[model samples]
Target: METSTFVKEIAERFSVINRLHPTELLLPLLREIAKGSPVSRKTLATVLDWPADRVAAALDQVPSTEYDDDGNIVGYGLTLRETPHTFEIDGQRLYTWCALDVLIFPALLGRSAYVSSRCPTTGEEVSLTVAPDGLHRLEPASAVVSLVRPNASSDIRCSFCCHVHFFASAAAADDWVAQHEGA
Candidate 1:
């Protein structure tokens, strides 16, 4: 697939995983995390002039939210502390939960990004430089991108539960697909 098509497909698939509804506070918090800042729940509460419990409750709606020792939201679904999807933007090193995240974040952030990840099946590293224009410096010219939208038609939270894996070859990805029946 062309880089733009690949990126769009990944973004659309992952769009199912997002804030349940428009809230006064949750989306802003998540967007901040998307910009690579670790935000303290308490600070958010204070700044937004919202109750602490209200802030916490809103944050809980976000997927894959990782907290620090002090109850700060260190990671959200689009950003992670440790993961195979590493995004290097400007001078900072950010992380995402999966390969698709690395592919799509540049468009979301409206910034150029340098991303690196590994093929789950072969463990071969794949890297790309994604800009607002397109992808460049992509390694491993041919690769298999496996997209699993588990429970897509169900009421289950698909975004948090879905999987997007990359592989060095179609055969390797097919092997993975065989092992994961539902997902």
Candidate 2:
């Protein structure tokens, strides 16, 4: 498929998945997490200015909400834990569940991010600087992002995010795509 078409299809899938949950709270929660620390339910409640029970109910609707030992959120799409995708903003290191998150969150956060991830097949590094408007710099200008149509009924992180990745180039993704059932 053409790059634009592929991006649009993937974005549409994400939009559908987002609509299933309380997305209004997502931006504020994401903003708090971007401050470089794990966010507690109480802290999230404070950030949203909602009661703790309400915050918990809302968070329960979000899939793959990772928590630390102390019950703090560490990964929600944007993460504080290390992953294949590294996202850095204002010199603070963060991570994301997938390549798409690297592209999307910079705009949501209204901040530029330096992103680094490896091609799943070739192990070659794909790095870029993304601004709120668009890509600022992309190393190996031939690089491309891989995407999958996820099952909406399943956990989004496992069904979609785990399959999405950055490739050094289209050619580099060929073998990997062939191996994965969907990409």
Candidate 3:
């Protein structure tokens, strides 16, 4: 693909991914996680001064919530538990569901961030820094990010298998698209 065309497509995809967000009730919890501390359901309940059951019920309403075998909330929304998309800010280490989450979360948290993720096809590590302004120190400056929304019109939910991945090159991303259905 042409350089200009690829840049435009990436910008468009980032817009979509940026708009994908969790519900209002879960936003604070996510921000807390972004700060590097993993919040438990009980902690959230206590912090909000709400009953534990009520907090759990509210969490159930968000599709992004992922629980561990012990039923602890390990991830919610774009946040993951030590995944390939590592988002580091303020000495905190956290994970994101897709590459784009690394790109967008810094702005959401009102702080600068350093993000690292592997190219889905090549497994080459890509790293960059993001501030409210934009990206900087991006290794493989030509690298491209991939965003797939199974349902563009629907609400953002973890159940939806939308993907936000990274690729070292357009050809690499195209190769992945050919192998995956609906990519």
Clash count per candidate: 0, 0, 0
Model with the higher TM-score, candidate 1 or 3: 3
Taking every candidate in turn, the Cα RMSD to the unseen true structure, in Å, is 5.0, 1.9, 4.8
Q: Pick the candidate with the highest TM-score.
A: 2
The digit string of per-residue lDDT tens for model 3 on 12-128 reads 654564455424555567676675555777877776778888787777555557777767676765454767777878878787777766776777777788888888888888888
- Which residue segments of model 2 deviate by more than 4 Å? 1-12
What is candidate 2's lDDT per residue for 93-163, written digit by digit as tens? 99999999999999999999999999887888999999999999998899998877776643678878888
The count of residue-pair clashes in candidate 2 stands at 0
Which 10 consecutive residues of model 2 have the lowest summed lDDT? 147-156
Rank order by TM-score, top first? 2, 3, 1
After superposition, candidate 3 runs with Cα above 4 Å error: 1-22, 46-53, 68-70, 78-80, 152-162
Give me the overall lDDT of model 3: 0.68
lDDT of 1 at 170: 79
> How high a TM-score does candidate 3 get?
0.74
Model 2's TM-score against the true structure? 0.91
Clashes of 3: 0
